[model samples]
Target: MIHAYRFYIDGEWVEPCVPKTLEVIDPSTEQPAGTIALGSAADVERAVTAARRAFAFFSRTSKAERIDLLKRIVAILKRRNDELGDIISREMGAPLAMARAEQAGIGATHFEQTIKALETFAFDYMQGSTRILREPIGTIGMITPWNWPINQIACKVAPALATGCTMVLKPSEIAPFNAVIFAEIMDEAGVPKGVFNLVQGDGLTVGVELAGHPDVDMVSFTGSTRAGIAVAQAAAPTVKRVHQELGGKSPNIILRSADFSAAVTAGVRRCFGNSGQTCTAPTRMLVPVERMEQASSIAASEAAVLVVGPPSDPRTDLGPVASSAQFDKIQTLIERGIAEGAELIAGGLGRPPHLDAGYYVRPTVFARVTNQMTIAREEIFGPVLSIIGYQSEDEAIAIANDTPYGLAAYIQGDPEEARALAGRLRAGSVRLNSAAWDSAAPFGGYKQSGNGREYGKFGLHEFTEVKGIVGFLND
Candidate 1:
């Protein structure tokens, strides 16, 4: 049983000043899975105060010291891998295998990657006669989402620790168990008091306080674009550095030079992966207008083959979405697609017939979708795919770039052509032929997908500030 009824602050499990609670639901069964204390502005102040006090000494720790700390943390994390997988699967409804391999394992991966980056990183260097110094930015307020709970937390928290910054994290109330487990890991690793804290609450109180807190030097948030805007607005008064990783309606384009069957199949799988909760999920597919029918057929076959069932079942390929809100939203969008004349190619408007009583959504597909359609324009954030046809390669690029979000895009075709086409697409990252995810490569977005980058050395830099002292080496 996962019991998390208190906040982790100042290296201790403390009760909330205001005793509010939220019952976390297991999406797979639509039942209460866990209960967590809800924090208020008073709670934020306590955590922030702890972080501020710790930053004085923590920020000055030697690089070697921080490295040792991360190593210890990673060791504990690896040992608790299965426990984290179980908690994450229950709280957020990812399949057990995926929760272990992708969700929980990625947390360990982030720390390992940060360790590698810190080993060779130079905090200070000379540019001509000038000495350049990089220092920790200070206490960070981190707001993470339920979709990839620990991945977001690790990316932000690992780098903060590496760069000698302290932090107070406000994990999504929807999936707080994984974060509580993370707090346990930190305590086991002997992390310094106040260097890391976890608070639980809604965006209204905890999130706003974190963003607008005078003591917070930076606020890093990952969620919907709408909520990201609120965070930026709240931070505007404090003038604290704000970094956001928001939503995406990413595009997947299949060039005429590629094999239609292979490209379309891959695109469908990626779109539905993680129950289509990934912000960088390729929700929109651009295919040749003439081959739309064939592409739809291939995509439908792929979607049908995917098994959606209880998260415990090892054979289950797709699990329920995170909550009822997501399920309802997806159903509405699928309904809108049909109403808007977008061809409903496969799977639509309800739970899979085999299993009932959960937040499960069918793996849906829509063809003949234009860029302006509601299903194409909005970020449905479910296992819904929209295939838009293009007349030519130029039209394909135009159609793909029409969205307000450009977090990620995919291209499948001749290698050289795909490489050339990648440059034309307006997105933070582009993959040619479904390349494996690279930890070192920067992950973020372009346009309204939100500002700044994360992962690897780039993430380490986000928690730091640079200063150039002129003529420091004068003789």
Candidate 2:
């Protein structure tokens, strides 16, 4: 078993102030995969100090120099890609193929995109003779969730580094091995001392400390809305800039013009991908009332064929949920959906047949689900889909916008119609006819789904401060 008892601080791995440790579990096997030291407030203080000291120099770094650093990191990450994928699959229960392709692949993609963004980005601009300057936002405190551990880490860290900001990161304790490997990548890439620091621990001690630390200039968090609120509250006293990418109950609207079979089937696979642990997953599917039965049938058939097994298995399409607690929560929600009168179309209530050794959950889909149902409104973060019927295009749009979240929404129809419908949705990102995800597009939510965008130039701007120098360029 891998034992990681030291925290990365000021470009070095050092013992935590309080020598306590937490066991890291492999959710698929339900066993201890490794151990990581639990950091304390003292460790946060040390990390913050280092970041603060580094910010004085790092924030003033030339754009070209920062681009070089990012390029180097991208190269190293590519070389260690396979190893990173294996660790993520073990730590978070993502299938081996997915772990290699999307999971670890996205991490490298973020850095490479950031490098390209840096090359053409205009850090300074002129507006009506006033020189506008966008400078680094100073020391940042970042808290990322376990669902997309490395993806979140790279999105945050790459931008911070490219924009010349020092940071202290607290990756989710549940799945931190990938973050540990990423820190090593930073070191090997010759990241300057004290520019990037990592402290592993829970939200109460380390997270609170990092968020509330007076020295930190900004706090970027990605997790549940509840946790995001807590982080904002903690950072209130200091009035630091808080950027959150929180939870979502995203909708996948199947318009009448779309191919019903293909739309519903693809929606199920997308919802069940990564065991539905994604924050912006399209968990709620809206279809025409008359076609609800047909849509539900397609979703059920697609879910039924999904292979649920150990993440290491190449053929496994759906692996176990990340932890036992997650499994229990999904099961409870599935039961609640039944109690609320929704039809159980596919899997539900327990582990898949003959699979009782892990935190495996059967791929479940519910039909005739009302918007008021708990399963339809709440973010389940599991392989569960709720099919809600809408009578008209107006009703579908209204139902999609009913939720408190506006993270993401999907539209499946003719290209023109899909684009038109996508424009009406109250979501930050909308997919048209299973469109591929864009790394350059800005990503974030409009309402309770959280604020501030990440990815490409938008992500780089999150770690920057804008200033208008008026008198310097007198009219």
Candidate 3:
């Protein structure tokens, strides 16, 4: 009944050039929630032109003006936080609590962070006889995924706006209601006409068009490595700047000295947050060989306590996977885990017991999982855990870095030991002793987990290009 079957471009809601549409299904009910107009190459072109026109003057706006704009955006977003959470839960199947606490909350936080960073950030720095100026990169093309809909979109948009860069957004067609609401916030916040635009469609159509558009100066993408590669390739011929946050097969190392019960149980629970669909989930857990049994038992017991049910249910901790395709993909991976001879310590394929309808999946844990196993190497993007055993601390680190991903790594041990292990890991961010997040820290990956960083001043810098003004004083 919610109608979002159009694109928001040039500060107005416009129909797509092509009338292709896709039905969005609520994963909790397995019913059509709404339909979004699918955008095409022409639609992307229209958006790019709009953003390009807006960038000429908007990018030249003074820092103070941009700061005020960001603040206004933050205020508008906060006012509609509850409505945003509701749409996210219905469209993406996140529990209402998580939608409120993390999904919508992180979006507002990112905006606030951008505003704060802009206040102290130096756009022009004196360098001896010359000055180095950090200028806005021209129109950006942002392609965000479904798992953390607003989190990714806001992270990109807030920084782009703070840096005085205009942009066109292509949120995942699977869970796009949050984005629709976000477009409304931008409009309400008095963003200049054409400074922000939205085009909804699958990756093949709108995604490819946006990445390949010559007018688009940069493409900031968050999705699977496979898709990231495609976006990079598409933009390669144009030689545009490509920033990616790709797939992650993160490792959670539970040292023998750490409290096994507490660490294992807590780790499993956190990994399953967001239905275990997070890109940086601790899907690969490495434990000492002797402690494998204990870790597995604790993880399985903890997973049992997770309530997988409707997103609207206040008691449900884990909601349904975002879509039917995701549901099928998860089941196939779980079956692959069983076929590869890994012990299904707790759950297997299909929905959790007592949940007959919905695209729900059982919270599964697999033990004795080798690094070479299908589930261990692949990004499952489901509420599934794989426990791999190692003999020594060095061996554990090796197994942890064995994957193609290096997004995030977890270490549990004495503070000193954890810090030491964290340094050795090939990941961008390491959570030592289960530390809380630092908003100002740089976040990115080393290898295939994708390039470039987000959060704090690092994210603001990503949206800008630096130029040296040599000998202008002589003029």
Candidate 4:
């Protein structure tokens, strides 16, 4: 077995200050896949200090320097993409193809986007002779979740690096191998000493310390709503900028005028895309009251065909949940859905018949679910979908926005109707039909889903503080 017990601090890999170890289990096999050191508050101090020192010089670098650094990092990332994909598959339980296509791909995509943004970004602007300037926000503390490991890391790290803000990242202990690989990539690219750091540990200790540290000017976190609240509370006293992308119960509205089979089937497939672990997954499908039965049948039929198995298996379209804790939680939520009287349309609690071990979960679907149903309301973070029926367009929009979350929403209909409905949705992002992602667009949530934006120009701005140089400029 492999052992990753060292933390990256001050441009070097060293043992944790507090000597604690945790076994990393493979979700697909339920076996001890590896081991990593668990850092403590003291370790957080060391990392934060390193980043603080590095920020003094790194933050002053020109845009050209940052662009060169990002270019080198991108090249190194491409060289190690396959290895990163393998590590992600073993630690996070995504199918190998998915890991390669989506997981490792995050690194390259963010690097490219950051480089492009830096090339065209205007750091200084004149508005009525105010001479506003955007400067680095100082050392940032980043805490990322496991489900979309690279996605969150790149979204945060890329911007931080692009804007010359030094940072210390605490990736999820459950699937941290990918983070380690990413650190290696940064090092290989010759990143300045102490500019970037990594510490492996649980949320209660390291995460709290990082968020609450006085030296940390900003905290960018991506995780559950509970953990997000804790981060905010910890950072409140310091008044640090806290940017979070938390949980979601996003909606997928299927209009009566649309193609029912195609839409419902595509929705179910999208829900199960990442083993239903995506925060923005369309977990709640809003269908017309008159066509509830028909939509339910389509979702059920589609879910049954999902292939869940080992992550390394090429034939497996989806893999197991990230860990045993997630598996238990998913099982409990499935039970609650049934108890709440939601109609079970497809799979149910427990693993797929072929898989005896691992943290695998049955792809489940509930039909005729009301907005108040437990499955429809809570963020299950599993491979489960709930079909809720609505009578009117107003009711559909109401049901979609009823949850505390406003991360993303989907609308299906003819081009004109879908576009109109998309405009009316309250979520941060609205998908019309099979709309492709525009990396240049800003990404974040509304309401309790969390604050702040990441991606494109907005992402670069997240790591900066605006300053006004009013009297210094000549008329």
Q: Give the runs in model 1 whose Cα sits over 4 Å from its true position.
A: none
Question: Over the stretch 1-475, how does candidate 4's per-residue lDDT look in tens digits?
Answer: 7688999999999888878899999999989989999999989999999999999999989999999999998898888888988888889899998898788888789779888888888888898758889999999999999998988898899889999999999999999889999999889899999999999999999999999999999999999999999999999999999999999999999998788899998899888888999998999999999998899888888888888888887889789999889999999999999999999988898998888999898889999899998898899999999999999988999999899999999998888888877878888898888577777778889988899999878899999999998865675
lDDT of 1 by residue, 225-249 (tens): 9999999999999899999999999
Give a tens-digit lDDT track for model 2, residues 1-475: 8888998999999999999999999998899999999999999999999999999999888998998899899999999998999999999899998998889989999999999898998899899878899999999999998888889999999999999999999999999899899999999999999999999999999999999999999999999999999999999999999999999999999999999899998899889889999987899999999998899889988998899999887889988889888988999999999999999989988998878688999999999999999999899999999999999988999999999999999999888888878889998999889989899999999899999999999998898999998876674
Number of the top-ranking candidate, with lDDT as the measure: 1
- Candidate 4 wrong stretches, greater than 4 Å: none
Q: Which TM-score value belongs to model 1?
A: 0.99
How well does candidate 2 score on lDDT at residue 38?
97
Q: Any idea how many clashes model 2 has?
A: 0
Tell me the tens digit of each residue's lDDT in model 3 across 1-475: 6778889999999988877888899899899998888898999999999999999999989989988888998898888998989999999999998898889888889988888888999999888779999999999999999999998999899989999999999999888888999999999999999999999989998899999999999999999999999999999999999999998999999998898888898789878999999988899988999888888889999988889999999999999999898999999999999999999988788897798889999999999999999999999999999999999999999999898999999998888889878889999999876678776778888799999999979999999999998886665
Q: What overall lDDT, based on C-alpha atoms, would model 1 receive against the true structure?
A: 0.94
What clash pairs does model 2 have?
Answer: none
Task: Write down the lDDT of every candidate, Cα atoms only.
Answer: 0.94, 0.93, 0.92, 0.91
TM-score of each: 0.99, 0.99, 0.98, 0.98
| Candidate 2 weakest lDDT stretch, 10 residues | 466-475
